[model samples]
Target chain A: MPSQAFAPPAFADVLAAAARIAPHAHATPVLRMRSLDALAGCALHFKAEHLQRGGAFKFRGACNAVWSLDPEQAAPGVVTHSSGNHGAALALAAATRGIACHVVVPENAVAAKLAAITAYGATLHRCEANLAAREAACAAVGQRTGATLVHPYADARVIAGQGTAALELLNAGIGLDALVVPVGGGGLGAGTAIAIAGVSPSTRLFLAEPAGAADTAASLARGARVTDIVPETVCDGLRATLGAPNFDILRAAGAEAITVDDAGTLAAMRLLWQRGKQLVEPSSATALAAVLQQRERFAGLRVGIVISGGNVDPHALYEAGALHGARA
Target chain B: MPSQAFAPPAFADVLAAAARIAPHAHATPVLRMRSLDALAGCALHFKAEHLQRGGAFKFRGACNAVWSLDPEQAAPGVVTHSSGNHGAALALAAATRGIACHVVVPENAVAAKLAAITAYGATLHRCEANLAAREAACAAVGQRTGATLVHPYADARVIAGQGTAALELLNAGIGLDALVVPVGGGGLGAGTAIAIAGVSPSTRLFLAEPAGAADTAASLARGARVTDIVPETVCDGLRATLGAPNFDILRAAGAEAITVDDAGTLAAMRLLWQRGKQLVEPSSATALAAVLQQRERFAGLRVGIVISGGNVDPHALYEAGALHGARA
Candidate 1:
């Protein structure tokens, strides 16, 4: 098993991560929408992580993880297995530190995402399109280069980095009665829960999940981690199985999991594009979708929602009819 | 003839408008794109007016015109002839003032724009799809309801309001070597010129025009306003005839005009979407297009470009191939 020596990230870790990554990561704006507020019967504050550098909040975690590495450890470079924002983010962070990065990308990765990763100057090792092949390829690379492997959502530094987004929100002085964030491997959700628990203890934490890949919700319902379920969702970013430490921290923080179907997520994404005037990804829309679908729970409350990412293929989004509310 | 009684807008007028609309108008952020800068061989600072209220900088002028009127005059409400951003801007501005707004729209106006205008609570008066019909309808509405007419881009108050955008840029302390703005009726162009002349005289101003609607460029070449040329560009916002006072001010300020073909404009728009991650309209893209098309003029210089608006139909933008830079 991977190292379980590091304790779960804490409020102080998030604070230090914020200071460490402040020069690199953007403090993305918190957007407010009046029409959406009226529609949802709540004052919605959107943390525009989609506008973050590398087009996603992954940059924050990646930057923190890269910076947290010792100079000797960083010199060997870093390796990861991702066909998504984390690869690009890590590549960019490595570039900033003038270190080499190897991304073991599956062959079936989205062309756009691959382009982005390559554009950031990461060396790509194409592997078969499966978790087993990807992990094996990543391990081989790590062994050859003596490069540290920054597990996308399982690393303590990465989790601390992701929590800074919520730290900014809570410090912005907005009274958020609750906070909603999409849960994939639980990095962002766990980070947010820790931030809220530390700074704004009264703010309830809610995790949004795609119904097609609703393992997190199921895990919470069964009171045990669910790992056998196969993922099936348009939210390609949120398909990872929940990390053990992340799940433990989130559960301890009393975070609740809420599932939103793909249709609902797509509809919320369209609303974000049309009314909120933000170009957010479907994975980012799940948080708003959960709040919208469970309107009564958020009614008359001021809630903060995290927009996960903006890196999306426009043609695919349009063809899927997510640009409009039409069924695909 | 349209009234020529009021003096042309001045720097003080822009300042006043800025203060008057400060309570309502969003101080849109100025965005920087490193990749785009590397591509264009210049430092580009984009004023994100697309994120402004009503999805465009038109709201600045609309709010200024609506709020500048005497309490009695404002009570009778405001009327305008527009099938675009100006109509929605005026409607929303009027609504903020708790007054009625009547928009004389052409029948062939984009349905999305019309819906936005209506969503802002404007009473739409549809007329034939011609300039004369729209003007006549607007005049009739103004005459019947005793409402003040807020010309979209020609009025002194409107010009002053639009100038506030440039004023904000100049005041932001970013040392811009030049300013570029898309020219339609020349309100934004003239306002930018006035702002540059008043605050940053060393900063040269350039006007971007689509080659299909290259009357502004032809006018500068001929030393006369070319009113007879019909527009055929995809930049719907920049199709209006140049206003007399606007042309005079722009000329006196020594502003130069550059024409970019629709293909170039669309290419720049796509680059902006993919690299800059902004949902800007074709009109806004023209400024960047001009910079890219006329590389020598702005080479190695810091330039501020106005992103005019984001109100657009996704399908239309896509089918036109502006999203992919392929031929329609």
Candidate 2:
């Protein structure tokens, strides 16, 4: 809560972030599915951020944060503690800026994701597989190398950059009545909320969380941050604790939260793959799953769902798909 | 070939096809990949026809052919003998026209594809698994119900309509040095050749074929059609013998034919899935595989590759991906 001492990202910052990242980021396509619309009883506009650089939307925020640094601050490098899309995105963003990047990854991080981060030319600093150890390692790297530490979601610049995705969607002239985004560390959710407020005030914002990791939903219901719970879902990208600043913006905007079980999320993931012709991770599928679970609330409304990322491990996807298929 | 006696589809017909199918068919996006470019040493522009309605470029031709029928002819509806993307495309196109569609699918056809065709409201008639039986069943359906038979690829209207994809690509102002398309039944390849000749005549045309189904390469080499060999590749959609009219057009265009082995096609399919974040079938992967396998020829050139379709069975994809991963 002490993070409240720092200002949250404003709507103007979102505009600036959009302009800042415009030359580097992809203007991802918006796809429509008639079958999905018929099934959900609503028109669905999918923002394909899975097609973003580094195979995720994380690049937008990383690019913004890296570019926002002053010459002196950027001279040494940038550092982050992530073993997932954020790490890879930050590495790529640093590469674009022609600066050094050091990622403090946990010892047991997914090898595929780690390979992607290293492939983007980031130096890897391994730490124990826990939050405290990872943070200590990241701090040590920053202290030793004079690298600026960019918190994955809690940072204002990162949130503002992530908001540009929704900014582009709302500006595309589609009259979406609602926008659904997956809530993890709440960067994308908070960013989307701010963008919707600035561009299309009438567009309702909804945050989708995995039922197994419903910290965001619990936090919203309790009117307080929930950080002590352990996440246990197939959506590996969405297991982070909610960021205080992100929660502040989301709560202030009166964004609603919905929880979907892993089964429902997997089904939605399969639909997106089978009918939608897009490869997105399970975390990205949660937004659509939440919408489908609450069909009556969204019936006849035009909705935009952000596909967060597509850096899925093929083996994991295969196993999950097989289990889901057998159960079906 | 006697089919050469019939007038081939002209450049004007491609224009007409573009206009005719504009209201119904999606003008799929053109996707570029920097990583793919770096790996292949070529600037690759992918025509994402895999994202087309019914999940393939077959929809364009099917829509045009179905719409080309006059009121009297359309009254009885259109029929096709296919158990692949073409059947599904034709069924959906007929649905748009509010006409009955009869698909003569083989007995051992892929169940998923058959389900797609029937789900689009087509009447399915099953026959023995062979070309003769499929054609006989199609003929019987035509005689029984007075239905118009629409060939999958050989028809002039179909080829013209298929050419619209290349037309749109060339018209997009990107000066492509060459165009590469998979030569399954030669529908897309011939259409692309005709479009290139009409719009960007200097852009060379290349036809990619799976080594297991390298009939096109043999045909081009021997200056005669090679129709006796059986296709044994993972590219199920390309198993059909090349149609006479399609072969004639491709041959006359002086299009170069290249062959890639199944291993290369599978690897390329995985690359498209893992790196490109697009779900493309093996047949579609052949184009990129050919480019990669023949990198010496396409180095530093800007090439347009058609991702022909994306309607893949998840089980098959999983198995292929697992095998490829194990091999890697």
Best by TM-score: 2
Candidate 1 lands at a TM-score of: 0.95
DockQ of each: 0.30, 0.47
Candidate 1 residue-wise lDDT, B195-290, digit = tens: 888899999999999888888888888888999988999999999988888988988988999999998998898777766766678899999999
lDDT by residue for model 2 over B100-162, one digit each (tens)?
999998889877778899999999999999999998899899988888888899888889989
TM-score of each: 0.95, 0.96
Tell me the number of clashing residue pairs for each predicted model.
Answer: 0, 0
Instruction: Please report the interface RMSD of model 1 to 1 decimal.
Output: 5.1
Chain B TM-score per candidate, please. Answer: 0.97, 0.96
Model 1 misplaced stretches (Cα beyond 4 Å): A1-4, A324-328, B1-4, B325-328
**Alpha-carbon shift of residue B313 in model 2 (angstroms):** 1.2
Give a tens-digit lDDT track for model 1, residues A41-157: 999999989878898999999999999988988898899999998999999999989999999999888777888899999999999999899989998999888878888998898
